[model samples]
Target chain A: MDRPVSEAQTKADLGETVLFKGAALKLDCGAALEDIEIAFRTYGQLNAEKTNAILICHALTMDQHAASENPLSGKPGWWIDLIGAGKIIDTDRYFVICSNVIGGCAGSTGPQSLKPDGSGPYGTDFPVLTIADMVRAQGLLIDHFGIDSLFCVLGGSMGGMQALEWAATHPERVFSAVPIAASTRHSSQNIAFHEVGRQAIIADPHFQGGRYYDGDERPRKGLGVARMAAHITYLSETTLQQKFGRNLQDREAVSYGFDADFQIESYLRHQGMTFVERFDANSYLYITRAMDYFDLAADHGGNLAAAFEGTKTRFCVMSFTSDWLFPTSESVQTVRALNAAGANVSFVEIESDKGHDAFLLDEPEMHATLDGFLKSAAQARGLNATKEAKDD
Target chain B: MIDPKASAHGNLASSRIDLQLIANRVEPGTKVLDIGCGNGALLDLLVSDRQVDARGLELSQKGVNACVTRGLSVVQGNADTDLSYYPDNGFDTVILSQTLQATQKPLEVLSEMARIGERLIVSIPNFGHWRVRLDLLLKGRMPITGSLAASWYETANIHLCTLRDFTDLVDQIGLQVESCITLSNGRAREISGKPSARHNLLAQQGVFVLSRG
Candidate 1:
């Protein structure tokens, strides 16, 4: 029998945190995470058939708290703009789920979590993780919740990587997939970026070979520098010019010294400094390495289209105009691959000055596109009021 | 003959059509096709007020859906290639608003529209306009104003044409300009003695009703 629901439980029940303990996650590399702890919150009530669930994968440095308040930051979820009431994801219409990745430093178990030996943090000992490994962990979580399949898998950036992985690995499990501002494989340029970030962290004097946690100091300077460098790539030169345009910080005239005279410099510094407080340096290293190693095409004989062969899942790939890191060309390539595989795919390049972060920002065009796509997909799946039973 | 009081339906400000101008040209029950129709404002007005059997082709899926949701028959098609699919003489009057400049093959699409319809109404941004020419001569680069919202690299308009280029294309294509209207913003201006080069730019935009010579 179900226990009595308390007021807090009732509110939680409105968007409850469903835990799946001891979940077995067998990775592609043959390593397994025994007793995996998945922390996820579900918005909107699951329909009787449990068919309306949409899983929103978060980017690197992001957690499961998609629309609700983040327990770690006590701030509204990063994607609250797109996932809350009357938003594009529309919590009132669809059951939404967002989970922290297995290797995430969030509330979910990660390298920082205690090891079985009681030897403190896992650190470097955390088994080498892959995008597929994360997907496998999510699969176990979905299984425990008795969700046989998801209505859709949606995300941007690293989250978009997970969305693609979900479609490629479990094509039947996902009816539709919307991957925005992402690439199918880790490009050489992306690997170079990650390597730079990794080198920056390792070069720090305070890093002390990833064992800095025991010491009083953390790799704040190194991590901050890495974040600052990486943040520059997330935006386009056009966006930078439009946003900051060599404008002086605070004072009217340029300081001319190395004191972040430019507004863009000051903004990047702020982003870097803010990131270090919430994210662990080691976790950053592991996640960046995971991203660098990610290559979906390499595993499928260098043919990206072959990766999604015979898949029935529909896809909507979106890219932003000012997102230089993952430009519209990458999204077009993804669409071409999906099209080559005879998969149903739609593509849109939203015009925005918000760079790669446009997916997270207030983009009316993106919202409209996503809303239309999701509603149509729901209708196609026979989930909503306009349900017409037909094979998609 | 131009109707000065013609207004579009739904988000009227988003459109640049003079309902009276369209009504004066198009009779009730005439077959009409609007290319790059934004929000189907013109088509909706034409259908309801003039009883025009209107169809539209819009590049934006949202615009097409908005048109459809309003019970207006519209197709999700680009002016670039999708115009070739329609049968010849399918429409009595083909309307192109301020969307001609944004097309990839403006001349080819205009010719196609003329072929599909007995008459074609083409409205385009006049690059030869004084402000644009001054912006080019003085600024030495493409102008980014309220009209032109994109950079050179991002603009969909590969073939930017002046009023002279459009008129020359009409001559070369063996099409007759039945009537012409010049406008600065939304107000019409007389172009009888106005220099096509200097005055076209000052006028900002122009519309030409054409038919096969």
Candidate 2:
């Protein structure tokens, strides 16, 4: 590891592995996992009333290193742009908490975490987790801090799924929820992409049936291919065509062999190779499965409105126009359900060519929308008037 | 003031006479849903001035952004399609301000509005104004006036109509006209003595509050 964050740096950046001892997490398939260590990072201090807490849920591959310095790459956190001292989220104002989900490999109790008895990694022995299970585990972490409710719960993609579930399962806890670039359920195309990635990992001989941790050989090729496929889903065709197009990687002519000739090919290969270094293969399988099975409506007796019936929590549902993975139509359907359920709701279909990953990138309109939404919500909750009086 | 943008003009009501009339009709502490609430000007007026609980549905992102910025609840959605999601009699008053002419199905939208609110508010630009008629007659082409500023080819106002036309539709739909507020050149017009024909010819805008008969 090039940049192993020092003890001082970890404390300074709120990087800590918090194990809620005897943290009992029950899976959707009637299985239970004990001793959950939820790696989380917090920015800003909880107010005296503890009402200014905002829980940020991360996407499929993202960990709890939100708005901090990433220990692995010596770079800023993935969502550093939006959650800084003076950024849209305004860490100076609200106590922001982000936790690595249960099925994650980054210091969380994932399929790759070492068994409690000091055996090898849990690997496939980890019970399958659902989005609700993940939310339930996150609730334990939030409860430990003595926060009765959060100011807001917000996320994009898989993170968005968690935000939706958080509001649905515990409507009283979240005053406002923002679910961006996500839907109530995963589309068939999403499942298809996930299935292809799983198959790629399974096809590798070195995978060793998800028990690759037993030997020195890891499923590098298989996991790399899987990442390559999954990364394409995160971006739009316009982005790829604009970034790479038919440009050659290094030469003027095609290689004519299996070697990468196009710049897109080389880019995907680099993305795949770099990803496998930090992420575990079995954890990827588990997380993907969790995302694939997330259908909020199906769980609520096939009535989407029933999931949010009589919900008093305010919602801001957003989607990018070019995000085909979770299109504008998906957000519209969600807004419809919220309206039918008489929920306080707002929606914005942002015009952008950045696709599903637009929520992570620099979207000025998105920032404005979020800033406006939160500011209004804060005022409604008396957060603004209180802080102003304090300053005065 | 440190920021002039944050200052509320003490007398928030602007020269939009129809808006003033609509604002005057709204009671305190009632629920209001303003469709196509641009920049949330009227909703903000209602919220801050009238103390009425206000919500909004705007079709454009910019509109929704402005509404949210002003601390008003506004969703981005269309009138023709998304109105069906709202439950019946959810709001005391549902206002469609100067947006009736632009709707794909104005009648259907108004019908949905009637169902969603106890009182339905609609403001339609008068296509039968004397200037519009004179311009059409003399120029031999589509007329573009101050209220209907865009060219016929480029305009988003697909179902433009006159005061008489709208009133006829209201009658056809079995709606009782509670009151009619007429405006001309951003000034309120008195319609008590004049006939409906004169109101249709002179008025540039008409704000109507209708109830299902």
Candidate 3:
């Protein structure tokens, strides 16, 4: 796929402007944000009816640039393979939209953004938020675009959580939803992992109670440790063995020292170090809390089925074989709940060794499955290939 | 004329159809459920040509979505565990094409498939074929080829069996074999033959049409 000439050039080529900005949503913690900003990018052209729109939510560390070059890291979006021309998503066929979520550090209103009280940053003082808050903010953005209903809301990981929220809350507004590698409720194990990461960040003296933006001496070490710990959960034991398998890093034998002697150790160190460069520590604290607080069943009168009661939106739930973070068992539970609710739902557990990250990687089985499903959905909507508008 | 508009983007090579065979068994406008409906070729054919009220239950989300995009009614659910949710005798025929072996509990699923539909169509690689037996005796290891493409450690066919084994299970479970068709790589073959150990590999595969006894 060819790169869009330039950001400004592509924006000019778009011929029309689609701004995504709105007012702040008041939090339950008795705090309010004003004049909130949302950064998003759109692909393909919306038809006259505007029913061809697809909303893609990003994962924990990902931003709104779904298929564009990231300004912060200068790297292409994490999901370029699945979101390009003629790809499984087929940006040429659907009007794809990806946005940075609320309570995110990446250009969205978050702890790092300016506070309503004219303070530099909200930091630890930022009001606590939830996944529903993020979804509510996304709803505002969708409304800003003048789109009534989304053709499909698709996402994985934390993005998948948002997709589920969109379907459960605004069932009438979404035609279909594809929630990949996610769970309806946060598992106790997941909550434990998030607590460990939070502790790692707070343990650093430089963290200064989450108000560490004053100096260059940020909580890099603590945040890096948090990233390393969380990264371990993102992979399966089988995948770890296949990729590292206790192999010594840069040496044949163990040195019996604190150095990264094992390949897995070195790999995790690299992942953690790289993550701190582009992420804010306070934002990590906020997002992890949001994820831990996610429990859809608890919110809807303790009935998981009632969360999606009486909605006609189609659902496709997918999970990876080796993803223990949100395993196939969790997905099956969700499917069972949906079945009990009598909602039209489909589920697939793709065999993969990539663990939780399978959704981001190039898995042929995943691609083939998604391509077939999306293409079928388009056809059902009466948008045949011959009738589909061309991208000049 | 096969309208290009009917064919959604991408060449559906994996979903080649034997329309004559399918049409002979299934009537026009009959309710059908295709298990493991690869790319939904059969359901698509039935819906477009015969105007059949076809619903599909596919394990692959991509496959289910493809069927949906083609405007065919389908749900994404595994035949192994999800089949029990369907009401008894929900469809006129439940088609399981080349996907029975990949299931964890082939016998249990087969029974479920039969219970949910009036009739069931099953296709499996003929392990009893002489070639498979020869390969087992000669090579001394599990075979890996196009149709069965997995090593011993990763093969999804945990419950592989021969044509005879399938018949024995059907008989044991009180299900009758309505119409059985043996095939050798898409070509028809005789089911009864001398126990040529090489027949396993040579026979390649077989398709059977079965119903409740």
Best candidate (score: DockQ): 2
Query: Among these predicted structures, which one has the highest TM-score?
Result: 2
Candidate 1 vs candidate 2: which has greater TM-score?
Answer: 2
DockQ of each: 0.03, 0.54, 0.16
In the order shown, the candidates' Cα RMSDs to the true structure are 11.9, 5.7, 9.4
lDDT by residue for model 3 (B99-179), tens: 777778888988888887888777676777666666788999886654565677766566778877887888887888776
Each model's lDDT comes to 0.75, 0.83, 0.75
On lDDT, the candidate that comes out on top is: 2
Q: In candidate 1, which residue ranges exceed 4 Å CA deviation? A: A1-24, A251-257, A386-392, B1-213
Could you give candidate 1's per-residue lDDT for residues A1-392 as a string of tens digits? 12212111212312333334434456666666555555677777678898888999998888888888876568888888888666778776788988878777775656776665688877767777888888877776676557888999999999899899999989989999989999888788888888888788889998888777677898899999899989888877887898899798998887767998889989999999999998988888888877777788887899888889888887877888888788877776776677456565556677788898788888887777777678757766887752343467
Report how closely model 1 matches the true complex, as a DockQ value. 0.03
What CAPRI class is candidate 3?
incorrect
Provide the TM-score of chain B versus the true chain B for each model in turn: 0.86, 0.90, 0.83
| Model 1 CA lDDT for position B52 | 79
TM-score, A chain, model 1: 0.90
Ranking of all predicted structures according to lDDT, beginning with the best and ending with the worst: 2, 3, 1
Q: Which digits, one per residue and each the tens of the lDDT, describe model 2 over residues B60-179?
A: 676676677666778888888989999888889999887777789988998899989888878777898999999999998888776666677777778988888898888877788887
